[model samples]
Target: MGLVVPFEDKNPDKGASIESLVSLVSADMERVNAMILSRTGSDVTMIPEVANHLISSGGKRLRPMLTLAMANLAGYHGDGHVKLAASVEFMHTATLLHDDVVDESDMRRGRIAARIRWGNQASVLVGDFLLGQAFKMMVEVGSLRALDILSSAAAVIAEGEVMQLAAAKNTETNEDEYLAVIRGKTAELFAAACEVGPVIAGRPKAEQAACRSYGMNLGIAFQLIDDALDYGGTSANLGKNVGDDFREGKITLPVVLSFRRGNDDERAFWRRALEENEASDSDLETAIAIMHRHRALEHTIERARHYGAIARDALELFPKSAIKDAMLETVDFCIARAH
Candidate 1:
């Protein structure tokens, strides 16, 4: 349960390209930090440690930045971007808090996961607090439509989580079921982040729809790449152990693919793992071999590339701002992470 992400130079194609996006989003994130920190000055002393653990854990803050970038590209000019951006971050953080508990994981980007440090109860309570904070910030945005999109996304994310719990260790889970889980867990919020800019900035319906589609596809691509990485990536490079999903009996792409490729004996092994008890490392190793034989990892990567291309194409509607360029580069950046 206790493993930390490696601290080293991963260098996911680090040039000077994303500096502008980072620069633009950092102020809003700082504002959020201040808002979060002020509670420490109030009576909630424990709030500081839990909140600080998340903040200092060194996440990319990608979701919130996407919201802000979409706002910029869509010609937004107000504090609503800040509020919505913070809202996106809080929602993302809440998911992480919950995810750690669900996975029984004790490490995130080289730090003890919150659930490990403070216990599952603390993690769940903190997650609920952040969810409330996210909604409160959304209300502060003063846009009911924005609120609707985010709330819907949050609901879908929760549903996806439950679906995964049900799907895990179930050999019957197919590509579509797996895709549904990915869409709910990842794409829905991404769509909201991308869609909010157009909504707040008063973009046309078509434009908003385009942004939503673009984000949805991009999020799927990102997760597919993440799934691919789990099979082929080094634990040191990935910030978590390779094949950890298999170890935990997660119904991931590779595992599903391996099951499909398995013969009668192989199917029997998987059935034992799912129906009997947890799988052993040898079971995991053999499963990886079967998946490799069936090229599941490769298939997932190809799909990721397809979605990355789609995400880039969605940007074609824009007339090309620096923000747009950065956004396009980000799509490329996401795809490149797996390479």
Candidate 2:
């Protein structure tokens, strides 16, 4: 749910054409950036220092861009989109800070994580600050419906985090449980961020529901790709060390499938490595090899492609435009990253 800098590959067919979305929302993005900078400032020096560390890092701000793009796709021409976009970014950034702490991560966006730079205490407090600011911006927009959606999402995300914490290190966690965790932790905000765009745009209920569906499915696809990438991707691709999920004992779909399908010896290996929290780098290599043996990563990506297709189909009602095409390309990019 952190800034997933989607496939940056130069090939037109493989990349997400993120530049298209950027160009379409360029001016508005600048305003959102300014809003971010202004809102992140504080009289307390440590607050801005910790907040800006991750904010200033090269996060693509994809979630906020989704907000802006959805608004545009809805034919919106109001100033509300800018504030809402900024608010969505704040919510995402806050989650990243908190997620790193919970995951005990050392890197983010190819740099030292905020929790590593500042203490976990500072990172968490700053994350709370960002959430407060995000809500403030949402309130300023004056749309009760939008506020309701986002506020509910914030709670759902918290619930997702708790669910994940409970499921951590448990190899018995099923695919359904994993899906629920990701849907709450990751997709809830994506749905909220996209849905609010149409809500503020005064689009119809059908359009709002479609955008929410698109965002939810896309978010699921995004997380699935990320889970696959953790085992197979390079540092350049994920901006974090490979095997982080394994190291953290995260029960991703890949791990769930592998554990369920593995031989007794392989299951023991998973227990010793993941459940026991004793995996070394060499063990990570071995784990990935076993996942390949079981085609865990391959099947996980297939699942991602399924969700991506659903995401693409969710946009069928929208008239074709640059924004819609870019959004569609985003689905392709999400699946392509696994390749």
Candidate 3:
């Protein structure tokens, strides 16, 4: 049931460069881009305008690429992958729009957030529109299995958002609780995106499971690196202002670890800074210092590497080829984002 990928070389720290992955799926991605543009259009005009605002903005489009690449890796030659890829992107975009509104965020991808540009109402409505469009495309694909996977993911993502809301500014949120939220909010979609490729490709259950496993673990690593980077990264690294998480009082692994290890005075600082939302400019600096003293950020990255390794290993079912190598390298790249 396993397929062979084009494996040329190996540099575990770095392999299968992103450029190569993009190149491998370039033609299919072009069709996906067209689908995205066409489906976003509407007579209301604002629909397309607001949709394009984020769609046209420079995003790596990594999620869709994963769908397309996984399909290729499974030896799929159908046009359905293009539609599925677009659906994945739309789902991801919808979440971003909703997330910014929920987080009361001002910026996304280095510009003022859509919520700010058009207001929260527009952002939310457009996000809903995108979700509707995503489901429509999934139906058009006519893969009941794929639809079930992605449709369920939408619900899980919503649940994850609510779980995060409940955990927000609550220092008692443990590591397991935080992991559950991310697995739902982030990893669910990744797993679905990768799983559907093999489902449509008619690969065996084992292969489909492998792809799902790869995506789920890769997504966790990606988010973990992001969590660490929020406290320790620069604007360039984060693609948005640093300290946004701290400023918003979002509970992430670094905060959880630091809180668990801190002394009473430090615990009080977390309570005031996070629970009370009293984080001053200097507080972010102090927070980083505490995280460093507690080895929080470093440990977060270490956790990411652990997941990245599992992601890499998930693909061991597939024979070595360039695509498999690239997929494996993506895990390394996700962890490397911390640097």
Candidate 4:
């Protein structure tokens, strides 16, 4: 019998979206967007061309918006949040460029990846440039604490990338190892993005930690849902080709669970397809079938909800407010995407 996972109807609305958070931070995001466009300019033409191609792509800009909203929640009064938000965005974009190259991916944000449009050499170089610019913005902010948090996050994210590279194509990867990878790569940045807001706003350390907790948990939930979506979501909803992770031999949480629970024949199939990268054209369908047989996708989403609940509670440190509510709703929005 297949695993029967019961999903809670925690978020009954089902229409939860990032619109609340977007509207809450609209004015500041405009400034962040302006700074992003201005900083992308360079004497070298290709630099701007390549950077703009991805930057202009329709990303939700959720990280920077989180920075802005957190700053506002902390009752910030100046332009430093804008700079920090832009810096956060640059760091994220740089990672995307580098990741596409590392993953040898063709599509990103519904368009050809920068690595494919430009050469790998150009893509890597431009990613370095963006990192340089991101650091420059952090320095301009002149907050040693904020700088330390973001810079440390950068290092952690790099480590996470390396960890992921090591785990790639290894079907034996366990859930704990996978969690460590995403916490380093994805959750650290989210934590930094929100924590910096309170740091710059001169909020209490407790508040800063709370924001970090919220971001960290939310980031994990977000990535978990993405992992589940890899096999279940459409190309349009995923913003990349469906089954991209499968094709890349990425051992995400769904694959991890399915591998552990599957029978001997299923285990051999996983080794052949993921460990050896010998997946045929119909193999993606077969993989999805195995995932369904084990209820891997449902279980992954349940794990996401587990983290999402923590994220929602993390914000309990703050009083009720529009921004807080929006942030809480954003967590629901992240998890609801799977449906």
Best by TM-score: 4
Candidate 4 structure quality by residue, lDDT tens digits, 1-339: 111222333545379998989998998898899999999999999999999999999999999999999999899999999999999999999999999999999999999999898889988999999999999999999999999999999999999999999999999999999999999999999999999999998999899999999999999999998998888887877889888899899999999999999999999999999889899868988998898889898889999999999999999999999999999999999999887
* TM-score of each model, in listed order: 0.90, 0.95, 0.95, 0.96
The residue pairs in collision within model 3 are 5-321, 6-321, 6-322, 7-321, 7-322
Question: Taking the tens digit of each residue's C-alpha lDDT, what string does model 2 give over 97-190?
Answer: 9999989999999999999989899999999999999999999999999999999999999999999999999999999999999999999988
Q: Give the Å shift of residue 263 in candidate 2.
A: 0.6
Candidate achieving higher lDDT, 3 or 4? 4
Worst 10 residues of 2 by lDDT: 1-10
Q: lDDT (CA) for every model shown?
A: 0.79, 0.88, 0.89, 0.92
Q: Over the stretch 238-297, how does candidate 3's per-residue lDDT look in tens digits?
A: 767788999999999999999999999999999999999998988888888898888898
Ranking of all candidate structures by their lDDT, best first: 4, 3, 2, 1
**lDDT minimum window of 10 residues, candidate 1:** 1-10
* Top candidate when judged by lDDT against the true structure: 4
Better of 2 and 4 by TM-score: 4
Candidate 2: pairs in clash: none
How many clashes (backbone atoms < 3 Å, residues ≥3 apart in a chain or on different chains) does model 2 have? 0
| Global Cα RMSD, each model | 3.8, 3.5, 6.4, 3.1
Position 159, candidate 2: lDDT: 100
